[model samples]
Every structure is written in structure tokens, then in C-alpha cells.
Target: MEERRRYRRLPIKLELEINSLFKQNNDIIKLNNKTIEVIDISKNGIGIMCSDNFPVNYYFNAKIEFDEERYFYCVVKIIRSSKQGNKYCLGCEFVGLADFLADKVDEYEELLNKSQIY
Candidate 1:
């Protein structure tokens, strides 16, 4: 299959906490606190693996903590989902992310590549 993604995913792991979920019409869905694993990320989106059952096209708000001082909060829409053993792997697109942040993702990837050369 041909790769259709506009940006390449960086194989980085981060823990994200699902703060809320919403439908396309902006109706919120209440749920207990759940932590999920972010498997990969790009400028436009991220791939996550979690046990929480999220239907495709639904939007969820999550906070990704890069470190002690850096935290990013965003809304992501589920584009694809598949069962992986006991968990579900979801492909999602970030909604309304700022351009500078997207550029930061690209810069992070460049820095990672440079580190591996040493």
C-alpha cells in the first residue's frame, strides 16, 4: 500500500490522559479517567494504543506531557482503529493545531536524527 500521510511519524512514546471526548456536533461524553500510550506522532496527528473503546470519527481531548515542564493539550479525531490483542490501536488527526507547534514536531524529528549520527 502507498503511504498517504503528509508527514512522517516519529517513533516516540508518551503517556496521555484522556480528559474528555466529544461528538462531531460538539456533544461531550463523560468518562472515567483513562491513560493511554502514544505510539507515534507527526505534525498532523498521532498513533495511540489504549484499552479505552473509542469509535472512529469521535473526538477526544488529551494532555500529553513531554516532560516535567512541557505539556501539550489538544483535541484529536479518531480516523482509524483496530483491535490489537487486548488493546486498540487508533490513528488520529490533531484538530486545529498551531503552525508553530507543527513545525516543532518536524524540528524534534530533525534533532532526533542528528543525535543518532553521533
Candidate 2:
């Protein structure tokens, strides 16, 4: 596939909860506060590996905490999904992220580049 992404993806492992997941018709799927690993993140979206498969175009709410008091919340739209061994890898795009959150993501990407964190 051609490289078409406008934003560069930063490889970072973070634990987050999929607070809510909804189907195309808005039916909620119960996940029981499952903790999922965020494999990578970018200004546009994030990649997560989970035990379940996510339908493309479906939406979900995710909460990633940097610390006990600070966290980032966003509604994500699943763009692509694939199976990796026993787990499913999902690629999602932010529905509409606030400027502050977007800035934070950009800053994180910069830091990753500076420190060569991958």
C-alpha cells in the first residue's frame, strides 16, 4: 500500500479502557471495563490490539490515563482492522478531538522523535 498518512505514527505502549463501544445502529456492546493496549498513536488516530474484533466504521470511546489524575478521552472511529495471532489489531481515527488534545498528541510525537523512542 502507498504511504498516504498525513501524520506520522508514534510507537508507544499505553494501557487504556474502552469505556463504550457502539455499533453502526448505536447498539452498545458490553466490554466490562476491559483494559486494552494502545500499540501506537498519531494525531489522526491510534492502533490497539484487543482480543475482540471491531467492525469498520463503528465508534468507541477510549480513556487513556497518563497518571492517576490526568487522562485523555476521545471517540474513535474504526477505519481498519486485522487479525494478529490470537488478537485483533484495530486502527481508529479520532472523530473530533479538541485542540488541546490534538496539541498534546503532537507534542508527544515530537518527544518520541527527539528521544528516538520507538
Candidate 3:
């Protein structure tokens, strides 16, 4: 069998405020509604570990609380999910993120770079 290729990820962590909604039957339940730690972030999306599993293609709004001076929102699309021991790892694509949020991502990336020096 051929080995599957994995996506290359950046080695950086960022704090994000995420609220995910999952549709159940005819109702919508909030699968995760709190602040989550973003393990890695890319131009297209981000990777986070949450407590529950959300269906692929589910849409959710993410509020990234970068610092005391910055906070922004983004529309995320669930890409892949996997259970790692007890926690669930979720990969999502940023469908439509606000300009302010995109700026925050850039700032957060810079902060991550600075943190590595210490």
C-alpha cells in the first residue's frame, strides 16, 4: 500500500476563541463553546484540539482573542477530525475571515516567533 501524504504544518501555537455548532436532527447543538488553543495555523486554515467531534463541512464562527487589544471573527469550515486518546483534533479551513482577524493572525505568528527565542 502507498503511504498517504500528510499536510505540512507550521510549528507555532496561538490562542483562539472558538464556538462550534453541530446540527443534530432538526436542532443545532453547540459542540464546543469556549476558548481553544490553536496548535498550528496556515494561510488556508488552523488546527485545534477540542473535546467533541463535529461533522465535516459544518460551519462555525471563530473569534480569535489574540491579545488585550485585538479580537476578530472568521467563518470556518471543518476539514478533518480525529480522536487522539481522549481529545479530538479538528482541522478547519478559513472560508471567510474578517480583515482584522487576518491581521491578528499575522501578529500572533510574529509573537510565536518571538517566544521561541526565550
Which is the leading candidate under TM-score? 1
Clashing residue pairs, backbone N/CA/C < 3 A, model 2 = none
Native-to-model Cα distance after best TM-score fit, residue 107 in candidate 1, in Å: 2.1
- In terms of lDDT, the poorest run of 10 residues in model 2 is 62-71
Model 3, range 6-25, lDDT digits (tens) per residue?
43345545666555564334
Candidate 3 residue pairs in clash (backbone atoms < 3 Å): none
Best-to-worst ranking by TM-score: 1, 2, 3
TM-score, candidate 1, is 0.85
**Could you tell me which residue pairs clash in candidate 1?**
none
Per-residue CA lDDT of model 2 for 40-88, tens digit only, reads 8888989899998867888888775544544688888999999999999
Off by over 4 Å in 2: 66-70
TM-score of each: 0.85, 0.84, 0.67
lDDT (C-alpha, whole model) for all candidates = 0.81, 0.81, 0.68
lDDT of 3: 0.68
* lDDT value, residue 118 of candidate 2: 70
Candidate 1 residues lying further than 4 Å off, grouped into runs, are: 68-71
Task: Kindly give the stretch of ten consecutive residues in candidate 1 with the minimal lDDT sum.
Answer: 62-71
Stretches of candidate 3 off by over 4 Å are 1-27, 32-36, 98-100
